[model samples]
Target chain A: MTEQFVAELRRRATIYWEKHPFQQAMLAGELAPDAIRAFVSNRWYYQASLPRKDAAIIANCPVPAVRRRWLERIAYHDGAAEGEGGMADWLALCDAVGLDRADVLDPEKVLPGVRFAVDRYSAFAREASWVAGVASSLTELFAPDLMGRRIEAFRTHYPWIDPAGLAYFEKRCVQAPREAGHALEVVLEYARTAEQRAACADALTLKCEVLWAMLDALDHAYRGHR
Target chain B: MTEQFVAELRRRATIYWEKHPFQQAMLAGELAPDAIRAFVSNRWYYQASLPRKDAAIIANCPVPAVRRRWLERIAYHDGAAEGEGGMADWLALCDAVGLDRADVLDPEKVLPGVRFAVDRYSAFAREASWVAGVASSLTELFAPDLMGRRIEAFRTHYPWIDPAGLAYFEKRCVQAPREAGHALEVVLEYARTAEQRAACADALTLKCEVLWAMLDALDHAYRGHR
Candidate 1:
């Protein structure tokens, strides 16, 4: 049953945003600089919200042992110290992509659709159970593959964007599997009942929907009928 | 002892940014429209972070009764639904102040100092004891007096801004004392030891520093000499 439950989640990867039209266009180099800029600018919101989301998960988890394991996730994104971690790498990517750091930091360019989607993800983490919140983050299970492809595509196709900006993807390629493995263990351990397993699956599906919706918004704004 | 602790916090109001030179200038009509715009843009980040901060406080709190009371703070900021609450009132003020709603919502204009200060407040809430977190919020205890003075200042000195933009201040005037009252009760009840009382005092002082630093940044950027 546990194997089947995990497999059910993996099956839904068929609809992951990596296969979304917008992402395909991005990989194909059909996206304009403006489109790429829009993606970078808007995606920063998600990166910025990560520590807060992780903190929410830590707060919700009642067991000290679980929280001890979960604390590393916050340190991973926020860094153990200043000028480090995933957020710094992401901002570096923004800089490499020619985004003015101030503009990206100030985030004046975020679209309504992008903001709504990201804010919903944070709200979900805040409102849901610790297990469900961890389950939603299981989207990381699919992330390593996407990051691998993204690095290759950006290197081969988007030559104008500095390779340095792709550091976030490279880091995630190494980090995602480890994080996902931990999350999977947590889900497998806690989600013992049929109902809990189903909820976990549903949470993964909801997370995928958020990613797909983000891409949908990007496509609507930047695709230009291509 | 509790009364003495509360009085000590009130004594620190001597350093409140209301008495800061920049705020004094603002109240005196010495600031340019650009300065006021900068203040509004930067302050929006603080406003945007409030619901999330409140959520952290609620999540850290283990007691059901405290969570129930704390839940209202989130609702007050985020609204019972959409297009309501303090956030909406703030955005309306943004609009009244002639800010492009997109610019404010995109939040690209937020200053580094403002963002740092606000993020620190959120982190403090997430990491500290529930009682300490609640104590930091005691800034609201001094808020009503500021809000009352601010409404008068804006009306008398900044007539160019729409009266409607001042709604957040008006709403907060009625809201601050009540919220502060609840927070005080929590602090008095939970912060029983001398060490706990000192920690609570320290939290309020840190909060005050965040607010003061925000104004300092604003003054540095916009004061443009006497």
Candidate 2:
């Protein structure tokens, strides 16, 4: 079964090879209209809904200290109107992508999978223990690398995209590491036994799969396969 | 946004590459003590929850003809008795795997992401049009191929895993193609507008991603990565 599980993972991972080199060489000046547009549109679910998932995790947290920290982090990501948290900054990037503010705000065009995946993540957090919920978010392990490549690539390959369009990536660079670190600490500290640790590890992997799956849907639906 | 989505998918797909192929190659044969144990243990979610997802889709069906057909299909999969349906058959496979039936039924040990992904999938179906929901289940497009390979691989590589342990896959051989055909017809017949066609395509992609994501998570949590 473990092998079965891993085989499954390998099959999914093979799809990501296409995104390399293209998304990796960036810095700030490299942003493109299309690329920025893609980022804004696709990341909307994550940017907008991540905190909600966090909130669910916080709500379910068995540990008060952990819950408090998560709530604060959630607030930080979802800041007060304008100039605040990640979402607004993400919009600026959306503008960089040429999407009208209204369109971005309007959920009509958003893909259904995005809605389900983000909501489901939050729901899982709501339903499961906070330890496991937090453990599942370990996809941040790849975020820093992905974010770093994105920044460098944006600066390098697609310069027409305004520097402002890079806001989301920049923020992720800052936020993802902090969030990942904190979430991992919680997992390592709180998951007390082998089974629990394995579970935690599984949770994190699951998160990665969710992210990967969303991307796969996008690629298949919108890109070369389509 | 498309590129990022694709990028993310690629990343998840990469994680799947790290599985121990040798073990997976053996997963289909006579039950190894380890493989059987893993199968029974991990399969709980697949057995326990798939019908719920199907029910959600069925509940959302608006067309009478479609609803009736789906209902019959659901019954066939779910069975009338406590120990019935494709899911129950899956559990019998679990027994073949090594898990006590009691533990296999308890969802507590299932990875939180698996629960979220599968539940999210069903929720996506229930929330959308019957056509759209049916479209989302095109993974059958890929299933028969995988099942055939699995059956043959098990026959050749993992004879320790009894053929009975693989009855689930055997059943899927007939089941998936029939279901996929029905679903494909639903989408093609109902999706008249270009946007609807696009949506149908997106739905199929989303389903694939769900499958892909599940696999990716397994790889991350169980195998080669951090």
Candidate 3:
């Protein structure tokens, strides 16, 4: 049953990739400022909502110290001061791409699929076992490298934007690895049974699909607007 | 304004602390199996569901490579193999201290505050703006040190449990800092305005209070019995 689930999740990723417009653009070599702007504007909902999920994880921890450590993640994303951190940088990204900050934050522009995928993830956090919830975050393990590639792509391929405007991705170059390393240790140490291992795998696949699906939604909405 | 908010949050923490009975014990050196057991069992809901929250975070990222890296955190918590991350270890601690896993997962047995706190966090995640949502996760910056203190306390003050059983806190010795570091970088780099900075602070305070309140509630509910 687990194997079947894993296989299905894998299939979802493949299909998602093939049909996703953003993926198509990257492959076909035509990622314009419009696409980047659209993507950032649409993804505002995601950046806005993630920490509370991290908070749930902290709250569930039995140990104060563990909870405290997890809780720090909340602060980091929140920023120590005003107008700094990845979230702010992301907002800045939208601004750089000519998005109206107020309209973007209004969150009415987000597509249904994007909302559904994110809401499903929230439900997963609220509904799944702690390990399963944490397992879903395992995707962080792969983020640093990805963020690096993204920065490179942005710099080399998309040069219309100011260098400072790309600070959000720059932040990830340092942040993703730090976060993923800790999470990886937790998973490697906590999954104590075969069922757990399978669940962990599913959690990763689930996250992957959700991510892939978001890009799919963007691609769907973004088709030929330029 | 930021200082006022921080002060307000701290004041709330103070009030919460003054009213909390169990925290008094931990502070006054009240370490016992029953107290620990209560804490562990009640915490199951939060501990078990964290990865799902992380999944939400990853699912929401705009970039593909970013999504992939973020997914690793889910795998860590959900675990790829047996006896690995924080959740399973927490359950082990519960069993060691005399908790029934069924009862832990069973809503009927959990304290109302536990349910409320966990659910509120989910709601916050669901409702917060993208930046606000990510900002809320900043609490993890402080996790590693707390985890360190916990392991030593268990090893030094509570000798009834096996060293092997202490693996949960022990494992976090490495995990907390790594994750916290990444999250901090993201928040610091992304938060771009004073208003957003303040918002991030509030989100973190809310997250911290949620955690502290859970302990407060537990202390109030179980002090007499423990």
Candidate 4:
């Protein structure tokens, strides 16, 4: 039953943003520098919001053992110290991609549409049941493959970007599978009822919508218009 | 008993960072602009951490009614939209105090000690009981008085800064007492056992320690040393 449920969720990846036109333009290296800059500048808001979302999941979780495991995600993104972790790596990517790190950090450039989608995800994490919030993070199940493809695309098609900028993707390629596997196990264990399973699937769908909406906004802002 | 508990927590204000030498130096106008800049930069981490902390408290809270009320804190800091609210106001303060908004947002200037203290508070909110986490926010109970005094000091002593920057403090002066009152009511109503009351007091003390530690790091960094 759990395998069937997981399979059902995976099948819905048809709606994932990996297939979005903006992502396609990115992968094809057809995006202009300004387009890529907009993507990076806007996505920084989403990246920065991850730790808070994870912390919310941990807070909502009633089990101590699960909370202990979930705590690592915060450390992963935030790092034990400054100038470390995925966020710093993303900033390096921003610098390598020719967007000013300060501008990205100021987040002055993020579009309203992008901020709305990211903030909605954070609010969902805070408001949803712990199992559903964990399920929402199953978006990670799709991340490793996309990250690998992204790295290859960057190297093959967008060689202008420094190789160091790809470090965040490279790290996530290793990190995402483990995270996704753990989250799936938790979801399968807790979401036993049909209603719970449906809720989990709905949460995953909402997450995909967020990613897709972010791309839609990016596409609207940068593609053809620029 | 509740009033006595509240009094005991209030008495701990003897150790609040407002009484710290660093704060005193700022009030006296004895600190250099660089020192004030460093304080603003480091404290930005704390201001930025507020919404996440509030979200954590809301996530952990079991009652929907309380969660609904608790949700307001996030909105108060994050605002109904970007370029609004207390975080934006703090950026204005940053601008007035001579730090670049980009630098403040970049968060590159955050000291290790300050980061540790702020991160510790966030973690406490995530891991501790929801009531305790809410209790920690009782520091706001002391905020209205401190904010009023700080604003007066900034205007009278540190006249170099633009008055617009004081907007955050002025706004908080009105907001804090109401927030603090709500939180105290929740704490007093819910924390029925002696043990729960003690835990609340402990959480408040830990919060005070975090603030003091941040100031200590600021004092060591920019006060006649580096």
- Cα shift from native, residue B144, model 3 (Å): 31
- Give the B-chain TM-score of model 2: 0.79
- Number of the top TM-score candidate: 4
Local accuracy of candidate 2 as per-residue lDDT tens digits, A49-112? 6554664564344343564455545556556433566766787878876788887777776667
What are the per-candidate TM-scores when only chain A is compared? Answer: 0.95, 0.80, 0.85, 0.96
Query: Which clashing pairs does model 4 show?
Result: none
Instruction: List the candidate numbers ranked by lDDT, top first.
Output: 4, 1, 3, 2
How far is A206's C-alpha from truth in model 4 (Å)?
0.3
**Which has the higher TM-score value, candidate number 1 or candidate number 2?**
1
Give stretches of model 4 more than 4 Å off.
Answer: B1-226
Worst ten in a row by lDDT for model 3 chain A? A9-18
Please give the lDDT score for candidate 3: 0.64
- The estimated TM-scores of all candidates read 0.55, 0.44, 0.51, 0.55
Better of 1 and 4 by lDDT: 4
Error of 3 at B93 (Å): 21
> Compared with the true structure, what per-residue lDDT tens digits does model 3 show for residues A1-226?
5445444434433433334558557434476667777777777777766665665555344433344345446556655455755677888888776788888987578887888887777667656666666777766564435566666766776677677878887877777777766765566666667788677778777877787778878888777754
lDDT of 1 at A18: 82
Q: What is the lDDT of residue A1 in candidate 2?
A: 43
- Alpha-carbon shift of residue B157 in model 1 (angstroms): 0.9
Best by lDDT: 4
